[model samples]
Target: MIKYLGRDDNGIRKVVLNLFLTGDKFTTGEVYDFLDKGNFEVSYRGVSAMVGLMNTRLGILSINVTGDHNVYSLKESYKNIVGSVLENY
Candidate 1:
């Protein structure tokens, strides 16, 4: 957790946003793989934890944990907002 004045929520949100930018549903391992390949230093444990927080607490993602590998996708409400921003950029 990267902290600024004793809080790391911003850092966690950034991680979730980056995952959202991938534009595809991804597993926790897949997220770690993507970050690793990009040379971004992040722990798999941290990613897994943050993904869960985003799904359950922040409501930024939807997760299906019933499969062999859990899959995560951006929530529909966020998708439309992100889609519009991406289109303009």
Candidate 2:
């Protein structure tokens, strides 16, 4: 998880790529499990902080908190962004 993101120069970029490549948005706990199982470098707090930051960095969708559960999803516009990356890649 972190390895893929770590390649990007920006923390937010690293995080967004992780989200993109994983192909789905995930809850914090789910992401926590993934990182732990994968033995990634990010901490739970670190993932939470990065989710919040993506809202500002992407200038689009933001994480929504529900019943004390925080859910992260890509903004609608991200398809356009992903298309560009896919084409370039």
Candidate 3:
């Protein structure tokens, strides 16, 4: 359900892992923009859903909801674990 982007796990995980590699906090829109640059062609809704799943299901990210924005970043404590997940993906 990576941001409900139609269950494209491989693509969604690639976007998430790439974003994680940056080691910076980013909003859902920022992620969407990055995905566009990577030619993922995903919608804002999809990015939003992906973020939620990444945080809740995968436990690889930490989310900060500030007013109307949700900023996400890799969970520092889970860095190695996330790296392993991505590597094995």
| Candidate 3: 10-residue stretch with minimal lDDT | 1-10
TM-score on alpha carbons, each prediction = 0.67, 0.62, 0.78
TM-score of candidate 3 to 2 decimals: 0.78
lDDT (Cα, tens digit) per residue for candidate 2, span 8-88: 554445434555444566787776666567656778897766656656655444477789887777667676775556455
lDDT-better candidate, 2 vs 3: 3
RMSD of 1: 5.2
| Candidate 3 structure quality by residue, lDDT tens digits, 1-89 | 23433455557656566677666999988888888888876888988887787789877788888999988888788777656655665
How much is the lDDT of residue 42 in candidate 2? 71
Instruction: Kindly provide the TM-score of model 2 when superposed on the true structure, using C-alpha atoms.
Output: 0.62
* Model 3 residue-pair collision total: 3
What's model 3's overall lDDT?
Answer: 0.74
List the candidate 2 regions with Cα displacement exceeding 4 Å. 1-16, 20-22, 86-89
- lDDT (Cα atoms) of all candidates against the true structure: 0.68, 0.60, 0.74
RMSD of 2: 4.9
- Number of backbone collisions per candidate, in order? 0, 0, 3
- Cα lDDT of candidate 2 equals 0.60
Considering summed lDDT, which 10 consecutive residues are worst modelled in model 1?
1-10
